[model samples]
Target: MTTRADGRKILVVGVGGLGRAVVEEALDRGAEVSVLVRDPDKLARSVDVRRLAAVTVGDGTDPATLDRAVAGVDVVVSGNGAHKRMAREIARAVKRNGVQKLIWPAGGTNAFADDGVTPAYKLHEGRFPGARDIYLAHQGCIDAIRQVGVNHVIWAPGRMTARGARSRDIEVKVDRSAGMYVSYEDAAWVIVEAAVTDAWDGHLVSAATQTGG
Candidate 1:
Protein backbone atom coordinates (compact mmCIF):
# COMPACT_ATOMS: atom_id res chain seq x y z
CA MET A 1 0.00 0.00 0.00
CA THR A 2 1.26 3.43 -0.90
CA THR A 3 1.33 5.87 2.02
CA ARG A 4 0.14 9.33 1.14
CA ALA A 5 0.99 12.57 3.00
CA ASP A 6 -1.24 14.91 1.07
CA GLY A 7 -2.04 18.20 2.81
CA ARG A 8 0.23 17.49 5.78
CA LYS A 9 2.76 20.14 6.72
CA ILE A 10 6.21 18.78 7.49
CA LEU A 11 9.29 20.61 8.69
CA VAL A 12 12.60 18.92 8.00
CA VAL A 13 15.58 19.98 10.14
CA GLY A 14 19.18 19.65 8.93
CA VAL A 15 19.09 19.00 5.18
CA GLY A 16 22.15 16.80 5.20
CA GLY A 17 22.28 13.38 3.52
CA LEU A 18 19.49 11.93 5.62
CA GLY A 19 17.51 15.16 5.65
CA ARG A 20 17.70 15.48 1.91
CA ALA A 21 16.40 11.97 1.47
CA VAL A 22 13.52 12.62 3.85
CA VAL A 23 12.53 15.74 1.97
CA GLU A 24 12.52 13.91 -1.33
CA GLU A 25 10.51 11.00 0.01
CA ALA A 26 7.98 13.25 1.67
CA LEU A 27 7.55 15.31 -1.47
CA ASP A 28 7.10 12.17 -3.53
CA ARG A 29 4.34 11.16 -1.16
CA GLY A 30 2.53 14.50 -1.80
CA ALA A 31 3.17 16.28 1.48
CA GLU A 32 3.66 20.02 1.83
CA VAL A 33 7.33 20.23 2.80
CA SER A 34 9.52 22.88 4.39
CA VAL A 35 13.10 22.84 5.63
CA LEU A 36 15.15 24.39 8.42
CA VAL A 37 18.68 24.74 7.14
CA ARG A 38 21.69 26.58 8.46
CA ASP A 39 22.95 27.22 4.94
CA PRO A 40 20.22 27.98 2.48
CA ASP A 41 22.69 28.20 -0.38
CA LYS A 42 23.98 24.72 0.27
CA LEU A 43 20.48 23.28 0.45
CA ALA A 44 19.51 25.06 -2.73
CA ARG A 45 22.51 23.63 -4.50
CA SER A 46 21.35 20.13 -3.66
CA VAL A 47 17.53 20.40 -3.71
CA ASP A 48 15.11 22.49 -5.71
CA VAL A 49 14.22 25.09 -3.12
CA ARG A 50 11.27 26.29 -5.18
CA ARG A 51 9.44 23.05 -4.55
CA LEU A 52 9.42 23.60 -0.78
CA ALA A 53 6.60 25.31 1.05
CA ALA A 54 9.09 27.37 3.07
CA VAL A 55 12.79 27.46 3.81
CA THR A 56 13.99 28.99 7.04
CA VAL A 57 17.68 29.69 7.43
CA GLY A 58 19.11 29.26 10.93
CA ASP A 59 20.91 26.90 13.24
CA GLY A 60 18.80 24.13 14.78
CA THR A 61 20.15 25.02 18.22
CA ASP A 62 18.64 28.49 18.13
CA PRO A 63 15.25 28.62 19.87
CA ALA A 64 14.08 31.60 17.87
CA THR A 65 14.87 29.84 14.61
CA LEU A 66 13.22 26.63 15.73
CA ASP A 67 10.18 28.52 16.93
CA ARG A 68 9.76 30.03 13.51
CA ALA A 69 10.35 26.75 11.72
CA VAL A 70 7.96 24.71 13.84
CA ALA A 71 5.11 27.17 13.60
CA GLY A 72 1.93 25.74 12.03
CA VAL A 73 3.59 22.49 11.05
CA ASP A 74 1.93 19.13 11.51
CA VAL A 75 5.06 17.05 11.97
CA VAL A 76 8.76 17.77 12.56
CA VAL A 77 11.37 15.41 11.14
CA SER A 78 14.86 15.81 12.56
CA GLY A 79 17.77 14.82 10.33
CA ASN A 80 20.39 15.90 12.83
CA GLY A 81 22.64 13.51 14.71
CA ALA A 82 25.36 13.59 17.39
CA HIS A 83 24.45 17.07 18.62
CA LYS A 84 22.70 16.98 21.97
CA ARG A 85 22.37 20.73 22.18
CA MET A 86 20.57 20.92 18.88
CA ALA A 87 18.21 18.12 19.83
CA ARG A 88 17.35 19.85 23.11
CA GLU A 89 16.57 23.01 21.28
CA ILE A 90 14.34 21.21 18.81
CA ALA A 91 12.45 19.52 21.63
CA ARG A 92 11.82 22.85 23.29
CA ALA A 93 10.49 24.28 20.06
CA VAL A 94 8.22 21.29 19.53
CA LYS A 95 6.74 21.74 23.00
CA ARG A 96 6.32 25.45 22.54
CA ASN A 97 4.67 25.06 19.17
CA GLY A 98 2.44 22.21 20.39
CA VAL A 99 3.40 20.01 17.44
CA GLN A 100 2.24 16.52 18.28
CA LYS A 101 4.22 14.29 15.91
CA LEU A 102 8.02 14.08 15.70
CA ILE A 103 10.24 11.64 13.90
CA TRP A 104 13.97 11.56 14.67
CA PRO A 105 16.78 9.24 13.76
CA ALA A 106 18.71 7.84 16.70
CA GLY A 107 22.37 8.58 17.14
CA GLY A 108 24.32 5.68 15.64
CA THR A 109 25.39 4.50 19.08
CA ASN A 110 22.21 5.07 21.02
CA ALA A 111 20.06 2.00 21.73
CA PHE A 112 16.30 2.55 22.09
CA ALA A 113 15.40 -0.90 23.48
CA ASP A 114 18.14 -1.71 25.99
CA ASP A 115 21.26 -0.18 27.50
CA GLY A 116 23.47 -2.85 26.02
CA VAL A 117 26.04 -1.94 23.39
CA THR A 118 25.16 -2.56 19.73
CA PRO A 119 27.18 -3.69 16.77
CA ALA A 120 26.77 -0.28 15.20
CA TYR A 121 28.36 1.29 18.27
CA LYS A 122 31.31 -1.08 18.14
CA LEU A 123 31.68 -0.35 14.45
CA HIS A 124 31.90 3.34 15.10
CA GLU A 125 34.28 2.88 18.00
CA GLY A 126 36.60 0.79 15.88
CA ARG A 127 36.51 3.18 12.96
CA PHE A 128 37.27 6.22 15.07
CA PRO A 129 39.17 5.69 18.27
CA GLY A 130 38.53 8.21 21.07
CA ALA A 131 35.02 8.91 19.74
CA ARG A 132 33.20 7.61 22.81
CA ASP A 133 32.51 11.13 24.03
CA ILE A 134 30.91 12.00 20.73
CA TYR A 135 28.60 9.00 20.94
CA LEU A 136 27.59 9.89 24.49
CA ALA A 137 26.80 13.43 23.43
CA HIS A 138 24.48 12.17 20.73
CA GLN A 139 22.87 9.74 23.14
CA GLY A 140 22.15 12.72 25.36
CA CYS A 141 20.00 14.11 22.54
CA ILE A 142 17.85 10.97 22.56
CA ASP A 143 17.51 11.30 26.33
CA ALA A 144 16.34 14.87 25.94
CA ILE A 145 13.71 13.83 23.40
CA ARG A 146 12.35 11.16 25.71
CA GLN A 147 11.92 13.71 28.48
CA VAL A 148 10.01 16.10 26.20
CA GLY A 149 6.81 13.98 26.40
CA VAL A 150 5.80 14.44 22.81
CA ASN A 151 4.28 11.78 20.53
CA HIS A 152 7.45 10.71 18.75
CA VAL A 153 9.24 7.89 17.01
CA ILE A 154 12.96 7.29 17.04
CA TRP A 155 14.03 5.31 13.97
CA ALA A 156 17.27 3.61 14.87
CA PRO A 157 19.19 2.48 11.80
CA GLY A 158 22.50 0.68 11.84
CA ARG A 159 25.44 1.24 9.49
CA MET A 160 23.78 3.00 6.55
CA THR A 161 25.01 2.47 3.00
CA ALA A 162 24.76 4.98 0.19
CA ARG A 163 25.63 2.44 -2.50
CA GLY A 164 22.39 0.57 -3.14
CA ALA A 165 18.73 1.03 -3.92
CA ARG A 166 16.12 0.81 -1.17
CA SER A 167 14.80 -2.65 -0.53
CA ARG A 168 11.24 -3.64 0.33
CA ASP A 169 12.76 -6.45 2.35
CA ILE A 170 13.75 -3.99 5.04
CA GLU A 171 12.87 -5.02 8.54
CA VAL A 172 11.47 -2.90 11.37
CA LYS A 173 12.21 -4.45 14.73
CA VAL A 174 11.18 -3.33 18.19
CA ASP A 175 14.21 -5.07 19.63
CA ARG A 176 17.42 -3.07 19.48
CA SER A 177 19.44 -6.11 18.49
CA ALA A 178 18.97 -6.33 14.71
CA GLY A 179 21.03 -6.36 11.53
CA MET A 180 23.79 -3.77 11.36
CA TYR A 181 23.40 -2.60 7.76
CA VAL A 182 20.72 -0.64 5.89
CA SER A 183 20.68 1.55 2.86
CA TYR A 184 20.31 5.28 3.42
CA GLU A 185 17.36 5.33 1.06
CA ASP A 186 15.52 2.65 3.01
CA ALA A 187 16.14 4.42 6.30
CA ALA A 188 14.85 7.68 4.86
CA TRP A 189 11.73 5.98 3.48
CA VAL A 190 10.91 4.49 6.88
CA ILE A 191 11.33 7.83 8.61
CA VAL A 192 9.09 9.67 6.17
CA GLU A 193 6.52 6.87 6.20
CA ALA A 194 6.32 7.02 9.97
CA ALA A 195 5.92 10.78 9.87
CA VAL A 196 2.94 10.60 7.52
CA THR A 197 1.33 7.67 9.35
CA ASP A 198 0.91 6.59 12.97
CA ALA A 199 2.31 3.10 12.49
CA TRP A 200 5.28 3.70 14.74
CA ASP A 201 4.01 6.46 16.95
CA GLY A 202 5.43 6.72 20.45
CA HIS A 203 7.85 3.89 19.86
CA LEU A 204 11.54 3.22 19.23
CA VAL A 205 12.01 1.23 16.02
CA SER A 206 15.19 -0.37 14.78
CA ALA A 207 15.35 -0.76 10.98
CA ALA A 208 17.77 -2.60 8.74
CA THR A 209 17.85 -4.08 5.26
CA GLN A 210 17.93 -7.84 5.11
CA THR A 211 20.34 -8.21 2.18
CA GLY A 212 22.57 -5.24 3.00
CA GLY A 213 20.70 -3.27 0.37
Candidate 2:
Protein backbone atom coordinates (compact mmCIF):
# COMPACT_ATOMS: atom_id res chain seq x y z
CA MET A 1 0.00 0.00 0.00
CA THR A 2 3.01 2.28 -0.26
CA THR A 3 2.50 4.40 -3.36
CA ARG A 4 5.02 7.11 -4.00
CA ALA A 5 5.21 10.04 -6.41
CA ASP A 6 8.83 9.44 -7.28
CA GLY A 7 9.69 10.55 -10.83
CA ARG A 8 6.15 11.69 -11.49
CA LYS A 9 5.25 15.17 -12.62
CA ILE A 10 2.58 16.89 -10.55
CA LEU A 11 0.88 20.26 -10.59
CA VAL A 12 -0.34 21.56 -7.26
CA VAL A 13 -2.71 24.51 -7.28
CA GLY A 14 -2.76 26.76 -4.26
CA VAL A 15 -0.43 27.97 -1.54
CA GLY A 16 -2.55 27.66 1.55
CA GLY A 17 -1.46 25.48 4.47
CA LEU A 18 -2.59 22.23 2.90
CA GLY A 19 -1.33 23.23 -0.52
CA ARG A 20 2.08 24.10 0.80
CA ALA A 21 2.28 20.80 2.63
CA VAL A 22 1.29 18.92 -0.51
CA VAL A 23 4.00 20.62 -2.54
CA GLU A 24 6.68 19.91 0.03
CA GLU A 25 5.64 16.31 0.49
CA ALA A 26 5.66 15.72 -3.25
CA LEU A 27 9.12 17.16 -3.56
CA ASP A 28 10.40 15.00 -0.73
CA ARG A 29 9.02 11.97 -2.49
CA GLY A 30 11.03 12.78 -5.66
CA ALA A 31 8.21 14.16 -7.77
CA GLU A 32 8.72 17.06 -10.09
CA VAL A 33 6.33 19.58 -8.52
CA SER A 34 5.03 22.64 -10.31
CA VAL A 35 2.66 25.11 -8.72
CA LEU A 36 -0.06 27.37 -10.08
CA VAL A 37 -0.44 30.46 -7.95
CA ARG A 38 -1.68 34.00 -8.31
CA ASP A 39 1.40 35.52 -6.71
CA PRO A 40 4.74 33.81 -7.17
CA ASP A 41 6.40 36.12 -4.66
CA LYS A 42 4.12 34.92 -1.88
CA LEU A 43 5.39 31.37 -2.31
CA ALA A 44 8.72 32.18 -0.68
CA ARG A 45 6.90 33.30 2.43
CA SER A 46 4.89 30.08 2.78
CA VAL A 47 7.06 27.33 1.27
CA ASP A 48 10.47 27.20 -0.37
CA VAL A 49 9.79 28.67 -3.76
CA ARG A 50 13.20 27.47 -4.98
CA ARG A 51 12.69 23.75 -4.53
CA LEU A 52 9.76 23.70 -6.92
CA ALA A 53 10.47 22.26 -10.38
CA ALA A 54 8.39 24.91 -12.14
CA VAL A 55 6.26 27.82 -11.02
CA THR A 56 3.45 29.15 -13.20
CA VAL A 57 2.30 32.56 -12.07
CA GLY A 58 -1.24 33.33 -13.15
CA ASP A 59 -4.89 32.94 -12.30
CA GLY A 60 -5.75 29.23 -12.11
CA THR A 61 -9.37 29.88 -12.98
CA ASP A 62 -8.33 30.98 -16.44
CA PRO A 63 -8.83 28.03 -18.77
CA ALA A 64 -5.93 28.92 -21.00
CA THR A 65 -3.37 29.06 -18.21
CA LEU A 66 -4.83 26.11 -16.35
CA ASP A 67 -4.98 23.94 -19.42
CA ARG A 68 -1.37 24.65 -20.24
CA ALA A 69 -0.29 23.89 -16.70
CA VAL A 70 -2.20 20.66 -16.59
CA ALA A 71 -1.01 19.55 -19.99
CA GLY A 72 2.50 18.68 -18.92
CA VAL A 73 2.00 17.28 -15.45
CA ASP A 74 1.09 13.67 -14.76
CA VAL A 75 -1.47 14.52 -12.09
CA VAL A 76 -3.00 17.63 -10.54
CA VAL A 77 -3.60 18.16 -6.82
CA SER A 78 -5.55 21.28 -5.86
CA GLY A 79 -4.88 22.11 -2.23
CA ASN A 80 -6.31 25.54 -2.69
CA GLY A 81 -9.34 24.48 -0.72
CA ALA A 82 -10.88 27.94 -0.61
CA HIS A 83 -10.51 28.57 -4.30
CA LYS A 84 -13.47 26.33 -4.85
CA ARG A 85 -14.20 28.15 -8.04
CA MET A 86 -11.08 26.71 -9.67
CA ALA A 87 -12.10 23.06 -9.56
CA ARG A 88 -14.16 23.12 -12.72
CA GLU A 89 -11.41 24.71 -14.71
CA ILE A 90 -8.91 22.27 -13.29
CA ALA A 91 -11.18 19.40 -14.25
CA ARG A 92 -11.42 20.77 -17.77
CA ALA A 93 -7.67 20.98 -18.06
CA VAL A 94 -7.31 17.44 -16.80
CA LYS A 95 -9.84 16.17 -19.30
CA ARG A 96 -8.22 18.00 -22.17
CA ASN A 97 -4.83 16.61 -21.24
CA GLY A 98 -6.06 13.02 -20.88
CA VAL A 99 -5.10 12.92 -17.23
CA GLN A 100 -7.16 10.48 -15.23
CA LYS A 101 -7.01 11.90 -11.73
CA LEU A 102 -7.41 15.18 -9.90
CA ILE A 103 -6.86 15.22 -6.15
CA TRP A 104 -8.22 17.83 -3.77
CA PRO A 105 -9.14 18.18 -0.10
CA ALA A 106 -12.48 19.86 0.21
CA GLY A 107 -15.16 20.45 2.89
CA GLY A 108 -13.01 19.91 5.94
CA THR A 109 -15.60 20.80 8.51
CA ASN A 110 -18.47 19.37 6.49
CA ALA A 111 -16.90 16.03 5.53
CA PHE A 112 -19.83 13.68 5.49
CA ALA A 113 -21.86 11.33 3.32
CA ASP A 114 -24.25 14.11 2.42
CA ASP A 115 -21.37 15.97 0.82
CA GLY A 116 -21.72 19.09 2.96
CA VAL A 117 -25.39 19.71 2.21
CA THR A 118 -26.05 19.41 5.92
CA PRO A 119 -27.17 21.93 8.52
CA ALA A 120 -23.62 22.02 9.84
CA TYR A 121 -22.50 23.63 6.60
CA LYS A 122 -25.06 26.34 7.23
CA LEU A 123 -24.14 26.55 10.89
CA HIS A 124 -20.53 27.44 10.10
CA GLU A 125 -21.57 30.53 8.18
CA GLY A 126 -22.75 32.11 11.43
CA ARG A 127 -20.02 30.66 13.58
CA PHE A 128 -17.41 32.02 11.20
CA PRO A 129 -17.68 34.96 8.91
CA GLY A 130 -17.95 34.11 5.18
CA ALA A 131 -18.08 30.41 5.96
CA ARG A 132 -21.22 30.04 3.89
CA ASP A 133 -19.63 31.43 0.74
CA ILE A 134 -16.57 29.22 1.09
CA TYR A 135 -18.70 26.17 1.74
CA LEU A 136 -20.98 26.94 -1.16
CA ALA A 137 -18.06 27.32 -3.53
CA HIS A 138 -16.67 24.02 -2.27
CA GLN A 139 -19.96 22.31 -2.94
CA GLY A 140 -19.93 23.81 -6.39
CA CYS A 141 -16.48 22.37 -6.98
CA ILE A 142 -17.75 18.91 -6.09
CA ASP A 143 -20.74 19.29 -8.36
CA ALA A 144 -18.60 20.52 -11.21
CA ILE A 145 -16.37 17.47 -11.00
CA ARG A 146 -19.38 15.22 -11.06
CA GLN A 147 -20.96 17.13 -13.90
CA VAL A 148 -17.80 17.04 -15.97
CA GLY A 149 -17.45 13.36 -15.16
CA VAL A 150 -13.89 13.92 -14.08
CA ASN A 151 -12.15 11.16 -12.20
CA HIS A 152 -11.17 12.65 -8.86
CA VAL A 153 -10.56 12.01 -5.19
CA ILE A 154 -12.16 14.69 -3.07
CA TRP A 155 -11.23 14.52 0.60
CA ALA A 156 -13.57 15.87 3.24
CA PRO A 157 -11.55 15.82 6.38
CA GLY A 158 -13.49 16.04 9.64
CA ARG A 159 -11.66 19.20 10.60
CA MET A 160 -8.27 20.42 9.45
CA THR A 161 -6.12 21.90 12.18
CA ALA A 162 -2.95 23.96 11.89
CA ARG A 163 -1.10 21.79 14.36
CA GLY A 164 0.85 18.51 14.02
CA ALA A 165 3.65 17.33 11.75
CA ARG A 166 4.16 15.08 8.71
CA SER A 167 4.40 11.82 10.57
CA ARG A 168 2.31 10.04 7.96
CA ASP A 169 -0.06 9.11 10.76
CA ILE A 170 -3.25 9.26 8.75
CA GLU A 171 -6.48 7.31 9.20
CA VAL A 172 -9.32 7.37 6.68
CA LYS A 173 -12.79 6.42 7.83
CA VAL A 174 -16.00 5.58 6.03
CA ASP A 175 -17.97 8.47 7.47
CA ARG A 176 -17.52 11.61 9.51
CA SER A 177 -15.83 11.41 12.87
CA ALA A 178 -17.24 14.77 14.01
CA GLY A 179 -14.36 15.22 16.46
CA MET A 180 -11.56 14.04 14.21
CA TYR A 181 -8.95 16.60 13.24
CA VAL A 182 -6.59 16.38 10.27
CA SER A 183 -3.26 18.10 10.57
CA TYR A 184 -2.11 20.02 7.54
CA GLU A 185 1.09 17.99 7.18
CA ASP A 186 -0.55 14.59 7.54
CA ALA A 187 -3.23 15.59 5.10
CA ALA A 188 -0.57 16.62 2.63
CA TRP A 189 1.06 13.22 2.82
CA VAL A 190 -2.17 11.48 1.97
CA ILE A 191 -3.00 13.95 -0.76
CA VAL A 192 0.33 13.30 -2.41
CA GLU A 193 -0.35 9.60 -2.08
CA ALA A 194 -3.56 10.11 -4.01
CA ALA A 195 -1.64 11.77 -6.83
CA VAL A 196 -0.33 8.41 -8.06
CA THR A 197 -2.87 5.83 -6.98
CA ASP A 198 -6.39 4.68 -7.79
CA ALA A 199 -7.11 3.51 -4.26
CA TRP A 200 -9.33 6.49 -3.54
CA ASP A 201 -10.15 7.46 -7.10
CA GLY A 202 -13.66 8.58 -7.99
CA HIS A 203 -14.65 8.80 -4.32
CA LEU A 204 -15.13 11.27 -1.52
CA VAL A 205 -12.57 10.53 1.17
CA SER A 206 -12.73 11.24 4.90
CA ALA A 207 -9.24 11.44 6.38
CA ALA A 208 -7.86 12.64 9.69
CA THR A 209 -4.86 12.29 11.93
CA GLN A 210 -4.62 8.96 13.66
CA THR A 211 -5.83 9.62 17.20
CA GLY A 212 -3.37 7.24 18.80
CA GLY A 213 -0.43 8.09 16.60
Show the colliding residue pairs in model 2.
none
How does candidate 1 score on lDDT?
Answer: 0.79
Q: Tell me how many clashing residue pairs each candidate has.
A: 0, 0
TM-score of 2: 0.82
lDDT of 2 by residue, 1-213 (tens): 557778899898877788888888889888999998988778878888778888887887898888767877888988776464587788888888887788866675445534544533554556678666656767778888778777888877656666646544567753342334678777777777778777778766667676442
**lDDT by residue for model 1 over 131-213, one digit each (tens)?**
46655765677788878777788777767766446776777776363555677788877887888788888766677777644
Q: Tell me the TM-score of model 1.
A: 0.86
Least accurate 10 contiguous residues by lDDT in model 1: 111-120
Best by lDDT: 1
Model 2: ten consecutive residues of lowest lDDT: 172-181
Q: Residue 187 in model 2: shift from native, Å? A: 0.6
Off by over 4 Å in 2: 82-84, 113-136, 174-180, 211-213
The root-mean-square deviation over C-alpha atoms between each candidate and the true structure, in angstroms, is 3.0, 3.4
